[model samples]
Target: MNKVELVYRELLFQALEKNNFLLTQKELSNLLSMSLSTVNLSLKPLRRMNAIKVNPMNLKTINPRKVLLYWASVRNLNKDIAYQTRVDVSISEIEKNIPANCIFGAYSAYKFRFKEVPADYSEVYVYADSLDEIKKRFPSKSGQPNLFVILKDVNMGRYGKITSLAQTFVDIWNLGEWYSSDFIKALEMRINGILE
Candidate 1:
């Protein structure tokens, strides 16, 4: 993920999860360890889309959905794939065997976060810096891949077992799977509920 995406993630996380839509550019720069100009560049699209109102002192997010969709539109999910292989196991078994220090993403993330799945899914995505354990467990095979390991960014900061709500939504939106739209619709409903 780029620094700009990180800014979007933090903005969405604050607006959706924390319900604190008002924040400062300097604060974002400090929290994300980026320069103030980088934060400004990231907010450009949102400002143009009328998703946020920026002042010299603080910026207020008025349309989080726009911010989310913008991030989803630009996110390159496949570029982060560090490892992928065909795990000839049930989805449950594949999820169960994911090694420690990995963050669940996409379908698995939605399931873990919501404790319900909108549709049945066939693949598992995870973010991890280390992949020796995963490579050993699910060796590369000459078949369709069911397990994808996204390379974790060093600056991706802390989160729970699953990816952040914004991250999960963007990741699912970038997926080409047949059921990804199902998850996207379900997540939109959930996010709308939260925003309401």
Candidate 2:
């Protein structure tokens, strides 16, 4: 109804689709570049309207809340048919197998991993929210996210992994004149040093 509400909805939907499952208020705060208080305050109305769902209904210092919010656009669709469902499982399962998270510190890192979506993140390209949850889902995860690896053995291959040539294409596509960004160069230097 209000402009601010619309923005919150957009951000929440992005998180739902991006994170594969649950995103904490802290992550949302960082990603949106908004204060935690502001994020929490704004979420009140969204929660009241049933636009979002908070799991556990408990709070803590490090991992206070888990938002299981859904986007309005696909509320009527079956859970299996929704795009966000796949991501929820894919990310968790992947992390479970890896038993750790990837360092998605920048756009290049994310592009090198996940294909480019029309989302914009300022820092830390990709990370997992829950290792245990997704790992549990991995075995039966046959949703839209398409984890890509170990598809036959587990719940994967939502969008699927890009081939090496395809990776080159997506990498180049996401990184146009990355040389111009001092940040990109710094990151490349760091990663390259590790390789060498």
Candidate 3:
């Protein structure tokens, strides 16, 4: 992901996952290792969307749903896919065998977040730094990939093993799989529960 997307991810993680709405550009820049200009540029969209209220000292997310939806709508999920290869193993097997540094996302994230799923998922999404290692571990075939390894960013593991809720929601939404809507619905309900 680019610096702009990293900024968004950081902001979303702070607000939704960390329960922190007070954030400064300087703090974001330092945390994300991005320039202040880039962080400001990324916030412009959130400002325009009225998703956040910018104050002299800090910015606060006024409408997290708007911010979440905006990021989800614009996130280039395909571009982040560093490796895609069909694996014959079950989703559980993939989940159990993922690299230690790799973070589970999408369906795997939903399962981790909520402890259950409405339906079985066929694909496993993960963020990993070593694409070659993943490729070596899971060789590709002719069919659609059952495993998608997304390129990992430096700021990805702030929330720990699972992807942040906002990140997971956006990734699953971008998947466009038959089961995505179900996951979305479940995620929305979970988000609402949290926001309340």
Candidate 4:
């Protein structure tokens, strides 16, 4: 993820997920290990969109759903995929075997967040620092990749084992798979349910 995308993820994770909307640029810089200027630059578009309001000491999102939709529109999921390979195993088995550093995303993320899914999904997406490590763990290959290892950004670790709701939505929306819309519909309801 680029710095701006990272900023968006942080906003969603902190504000929407954690219910902490009082964020200062300095705090963001400190937490993200980014320069003050970069954080400022990242917030500019959000300000223009009215998704966030910039104050003297802090910034607050006015419409998180707008911010999320904006991110979904811009996110390039394919560019983030570091590695893709087929693993001959059940999806649960693949989930269980992934390295600790990897954060489950997409369908797996939905399952983690909601504890259920509308239907079964074959793919297991994860964000990891090193694709080589994942490859080593699941060495055996097959026809098509049921496993997608996305390159992890520096700031992504804060969300822990599963991708944040915003991250999961964006990733699944970008997938363009047959079942992606189903996941997106379910996720939208879940997100709305939380925000309400």
Error of 3 at 110 (Å): 0.9
List CA RMSD, all candidates: 1.2, 18.1, 1.1, 1.4
The reply for model 2, stretches above 4 Å from the true place, is 1-21, 56-196
Model 2 lDDT per residue over 30-137, tens place: 655567787677667557655456666422221111222222221221222211223343333443343233222234344545454324432212223343443454
TM-score of 3: 0.96
Query: Better model by TM-score, 1 or 2?
Result: 1
lDDT of 4: 0.88
**Each prediction's TM-score against the native?**
0.96, 0.25, 0.96, 0.94
Please give, for residues 23-62, the per-residue lDDT of candidate 4 as tens digits.
8999999999999999999888889989999999889977
Residue 25 in candidate 4, Cα distance off native in Å: 1.0
Error of 1 at 31 (Å): 1.2
What C-alpha lDDT do the candidate models reach, one value each?
A: 0.91, 0.36, 0.88, 0.88
How many angstroms is residue 90 displaced in model 4 relative to the true structure, after the best TM-score fit? 1.6
Q: Which scores higher on lDDT, 1 or 2?
A: 1
The candidates, ranked best first by lDDT, are 1, 4, 3, 2
Which candidate number maximizes lDDT? 1
Clashing pairs in 3: none
